[model samples]
Structures are given as structure tokens and as C-alpha cells.
Target: MNREDFWEIVERSRAEVGDTRDAASAAAVARHVVARLTALGPSTAVEFQHFYEALNEESYRWDLWAAAYLMRSGCSDDGFDYFRGWLVAQGRVVWEQAVADPDSLAAVGVDPDDDMVDCEAMVAAAGDAHATSTGDREAFWAALEQTEGDDEPAAPADPAGEDFDFDDDEQMRARLPRLAAVYRPVQ
Candidate 1:
């Protein structure tokens, strides 16, 4: 598959994962990934592992793929370290890139800050929110949370509060601005 096709498959697979997925559902997602990879071509397990690892940089579901690849390739520790390092590096790159081109932030409705916040912290918080969220709203919140800021402990959810449904893509997009606003760096 071409790059567009590959991403389409990845996006479709991501859409399949739900808030309360069971083992079987998880397996189905895995099967979809494996099928997509297989269609791409045969590679050494190690090569496939690396492909998945790199893909995870863009696709969150590929995080598990990277872990599985590392395990199957006998590089679990290396995989973990590599993934962590890659994320740390990515966080920095994103921050620097944003700093270099302040206008880019406008695409996401964020203003450039002379004193940018901690990018890593912002990314981690976004990632955490994404992990706990469901559907497109989850993706939106995650994307919004990607910014420069100090890392902070996530506030505990109120037990008495009603949980929001995150299944609709439109709802997610609508909430993106709010989520992004939370991570805006203080100038």
C-alpha cells in the first residue's frame, strides 16, 4: 500500500478501538495491524518491529505493536528505552519546531510564547488523557494537550460526576479548543 493507503488503514484500525474493549476486540485490532503489515510485504521480524516502532511515532495504537515487536524480536529492554527516548526527542523536536515557526501554532489556535512551557509535560498529559478517553473526543483531547508546559499530576476524577461519552468525532473536535486551552503556556 502507498503512504496514504497505509495511513488510512492505520486510522481505520484506530477507529475500531473502543472505550471498553475486551481481549477479543484487542486481538481483532492486532489482527488488522498484522494484516496491513503483511500486505505491505514480508520482512524479518526485527524489521517489522522497527516499522511498527516508527509508526507508533504517529499512530498511538502502534505503541502496542512496537512492544510486541520488541518482545518477538528479543529486544524488549531496547525497545522500551528506544520508545522512551524517541518520545522525549519528539517532544523536544515539536517544541523547537513550534518555537522556530510560531505561526504553526495558529493552525491549532495556540499563540506562540516567548517563554514556552515544558513540551514533554504537555505531551504526557495529553497522552494520559487520550489513554483514558474514548472515541474521537479522546483523539481531540490528546491532540489539544500536545503543547509546551510543565508536567503536572492529573486531577482525580470526581466519583459523583457523570462520565462524558467520547464516541463522536464532531464532539471531539468541538472539545479540542477547550483541551488545548488548558495546556496553553503562560507568556
Candidate 2:
């Protein structure tokens, strides 16, 4: 599935998730996405996995990580992974903005009091959907490999772009002035 299709699924899930975008609500979104994927059938569910991984790969950047670090006060490697999942749950507009200009995220708004900017369920949604639809997740992966070869997006050795010390307050403020103004002070 292309990004447009992926976003449609995500947004549809968000609609199911209703008005709140908090972590508590994210599980429902994942459930909705799984139901939607199951309805779409197994092949598209597998395609959704590839597209989800590609979007995650596309978003694996130092700048975005910095944004995550600031939003959550500190971000570990796995924390960033979950952050990417949450970012995906935010739908195309927020995800694209975070990738293109993470500072733009300040305008998108988040609850500073709510630090659960992680959606573990979303990370597992496609696989769960595949299993729910096909009864065996490995069978779907094998089918994908047989039909199109292994084209899963790989995680980079490190995030793309210049690395920096996220714990340094000065660097955080300078790198993400708007976000620092919003979340850093709150933290």
C-alpha cells in the first residue's frame, strides 16, 4: 500500500478512536486499524506492514528523535521506536510535518501533562491484523517473499543526520525553539 492508502487506514482508525489522541485512546485506534486491515484482506495487510515499516524508516532521523526527546523529557532507543509508532497514529499530516520539520510539531499541539507519547499497539497492529486475517502470520510473510521477495524496510544503523546530545538543555532549546517553549518548560 502507498502512503495515501496507509493514511486512509490510519485516519479511519483515528475516526474510530474518536476525539482524543492520547495514549489511552491509541489502543482503540490499533483495534480499529486491525479490523480495517482484516476487512481489506491478507495481501493488503502484508502490504500495510511494508508501508508502515517504510514510513518508520523514513521518519528515523536525528532531528525527529530530538523532537521526541524534548516532548518526553528524555528518549531512549526503544522510546524513540514507540514515538515513531505514535507519530504514525497521528496520521499523515502530523507525521509528514514531523519528518519535514519537527519544530512544526509544536503547532500540532500535544498535552504536556500526558507523557505517554508512545503507542506500542500501533507497532504491532499490522502483524496482528495479518494473523487475524490469515490465521498464520509466517504464512503471509512467506507468501510475500515468494511473490515479491523480501522487501521489508530495514532499520538504519543509526538515525539519519547529525547526532547531538539530547540531554543538553542549550542544544535542545536551540534546535527546537518552539517545542522547547512548549514542552521543555513544562518538563
Candidate 3:
């Protein structure tokens, strides 16, 4: 499927499922994508894998990770996957903005009262399906590693003397107030 078609499926699943974080919603979308692939033939599965990988890569920004930490306390490697999936579910505008500059999410308007939109369910589901499609675990990862590459290398520290604490919630919020403002779940 083309990018538009792929996004439509994601959005439609979001509309029906509401929160991708919900296990049921993510599973539904995963099933839907796998089912749709049958019509296009086997190659589409690979294509879907590539698309999902690219999206995952696009979200590998420190800003987005800060947002994820705010939303979920701390974002692990897998948590980042879910975060990117959630970003994708926000639709093209939000996804594009985040991809361009993750910090821009702070400025983008969002209804704070709305329930957490967890797009990761859909994304993880797609990736899971792709890996399972061929039943070759080793080859699957080997292929993904080749295409996805290693996670972005850590940035060199500044020579000046300022230190950044990624693990500090307060620091993250101060650094990305707009993003923290919108995504911090109301207690």
C-alpha cells in the first residue's frame, strides 16, 4: 500500500479503536493490516515493515523521548516504539511536525482533555506481523538491522560545563515546556 493508504488504515483503526494503547485496538489494526496485505500479495508485508521502520527512525529524537517520558514516566527502547506509533496515530499533520522537529510538538495545539492517544499498539502490531510472516527470526532482525541501522548515536557533550539530565522529570519539563504542557497527564 502507498503512504496514503497506509495512513488511512492507521487513522481508521484509531477512529474505531480510539486509543491505540488499548490492547484490543492495537490488535484490531494489526489484524486489519495483515488481512489487507493478502490482497496485495506477499511483498506488501515487506513494504509495510519498511514503512514502519522509517516511521520509527523518524521519531528517534531527544525531544520526543522527553515527551514520552512525560506521558509514561520513563520511556524504554520499546516505549519509544509505542511513542512513535502514538505519533503516527496523531495523523499526518502531527506526525509530520514531530518528524521535522520533535520540539515543535510543544507549539502544536492539542486538546489536553482528550484521552491518551496510543498509536504504538498499531505500530508494534505491524512490526510483529512482519517478523512472524516469514517465521525466520534471525533473518528478520538481520534485515531490520541492515535497513534501520543503529539507533542515532549519542550527541557529544558540550565543552562548556553545562550538564543535561535526561532522567530528571523536572529538567525535561523545563526543557520542553510546550510538549510537557500538552502531554503531561492530568492527575
Supply candidate 3's per-residue lDDT for 69: 62
**Residues 41-157 of candidate 3: C-alpha lDDT, one tens digit per residue:** 445555666776657665666666666666555667677666677676556677887766566765544444443435555565544555556655455556555655467443333
Q: How far is candidate 3 from the true structure (C-alpha RMSD, Å)?
A: 5.9
Candidate 3 segments whose C-alpha is farther than 4 A from its true place? 18-27, 101-121, 127-163, 182-187
- Please report, in order, the local distance difference test score of every candidate based on alpha carbons: 0.33, 0.84, 0.60
Residues 1-187 of candidate 2 have per-residue lDDT tens digits of 7878989999999987775357777777888898999899888888888788788889989999999988877889888988888888888888898899999988866887778888888888888888888899787778556655465444688889989998888898899989988987745
105 Cα displacement, candidate 2 (Å): 1.6
RMSD of 2: 2.2
Candidate 1 per-residue C-alpha lDDT over 72-109 given as tens digits, one digit per residue, 9 for 90 to 100: 23224334333332222223333233333322223432
Candidate 1: count of backbone clashes, pairs at least 3 residues apart or interchain: 2
Record all residue pairs in model 1 with backbone atoms less than 3 Å apart, i.e. clashing.
117-149, 118-149
Q: What is the lDDT of residue 75 in candidate 1?
A: 25
lDDT score of model 3?
A: 0.60
